[model samples]
Target: MAIEDNPSREALEFEGQTTVIHDYAAKLVPGILQTEAYAREVLGSGARPKSDEERDRLLSTRLARAGILGDFHSPVMWSLLDEAVLRRPIGGPAVMCHQLRHIAALGEQRRVRLHVLPFEVGAHSLLDGIVSLMWFEDLPPIAYVEGLRTGRAPFCS
Candidate 1:
């Protein structure tokens, strides 16, 4: 869940038009379904095993293909789950019960909003990790933070 964790103040008031930010939980869908089921079980053999309603319909068709890009809108502020990410159940238990029922059906969209920060909401202030903010149009707002490898862009000056 990252598009700079929701930082598109109307895509920074609209300018040229290009605001891409992604994190998708570090792109870890059980290590990409175990590397696409070991590359379709060695490239072939009709390797199949994606039930749970076809992995929640391929994660709701990749979240509606990122809401069809341009003018894409989501996170009208609220998806903050962290209680060990809803009790850490990744691709098990029916892929975490169909990924928590496909994140409760994409939080019954209306521009989604699904808060769940309870692990007792312990610790504080970004817990020494995860950050993203962007707003482009008139360009003047960007903050990205990620590590344990590298990534840190701080703009807005």
Candidate 2:
């Protein structure tokens, strides 16, 4: 599921840190790191949006969320991506090239750390879904998992 699908006010208010494990095979991207073209394609294609307008609205929201990454109190973010994510051309060659370059640029920034899990790693744990963990200064961490068309945040010890 896309971050746009999870319009939680709490997530917007969060000001701390975040860690993400992303497998593009599951059809999702780490929101703070997606390019406009890449996000447009993913959100538009997968949701079968009712109309172009709706798709644009959703895409806008998703892209807006990325703005938090640029805020003065932005969270320190780390993203681990499956190698397949770098290989997949979600929006054709030009779009993908731009997306990858964007990711590379983010890595050059001080606030984000990006890593790729090469296929050579073979099979291991966390193959079940995409996971995102957010840690806040004054609240318990929250974990969000995505599978198929749904997502859940099961908060417990």
Candidate 3:
């Protein structure tokens, strides 16, 4: 399938594909890797969902995106996270503890690889924002950068 920019969370898909996620999170955990409680906290603080029902629906969708990681034929996932991602306490200490443990568990999975970029690494190439690169057999590699507004662009391999 041809790759496309996905600004809408509901339409994002990695399913049974090879995906590489590199994120520099200064605020909260990355969306695809967030726990339910973590996601709710992150979303709640920023989006200001009109009602609890809407928030739940959005949270459910975020959780559903995680389904691909555990499917029968799961995708190859490589997540490179900044060390700062672990330092932020988005939903209090308990939530952060759970989230960190969850991330470690996910990293232990066969199809998932997690790398943490230490703060001592100093200046680096990817210092700007969160970037996700999706690879498919038939189409050229596509990349997405997250910021004030997400933009889909091609990252030349």
Best by lDDT: 3
Overall lDDT per candidate, in order of appearance: 0.40, 0.63, 0.66
The model with the greater lDDT, 1 or 3, is 3
User: For residues 4-123, what per-residue lDDT tens digits would candidate 2 score against the true structure?
Assistant: 554422344342244332223323456556788987887667544447876676567667767776754677677778887788898999999998888887778755677777889888
How do all models score by TM-score? 0.25, 0.78, 0.77
Clashing pairs in 3: none
Q: lDDT by residue for model 3 over 11-116, one digit each (tens)?
A: 2554335444444554446677789989788667754334687667667766877777776465577778888889988899999999999899887765468888
Q: Any runs in candidate 3 off by more than 4 Å, and if so which? A: 1-11, 14-26, 47-50, 148-157
Q: Which candidate comes out best when scored by TM-score?
A: 2
Ordering by TM-score: 2, 3, 1
Q: Which consecutive 10 residues in model 2 have the weakest lDDT in total? A: 18-27
**Residue-level error in angstroms, candidate 2, position 35:** 1.0
Residue 90 local lDDT, model 1 = 48
Write down the lDDT that model 2 would get. 0.63
Tell me the lDDT of candidate 1.
0.40
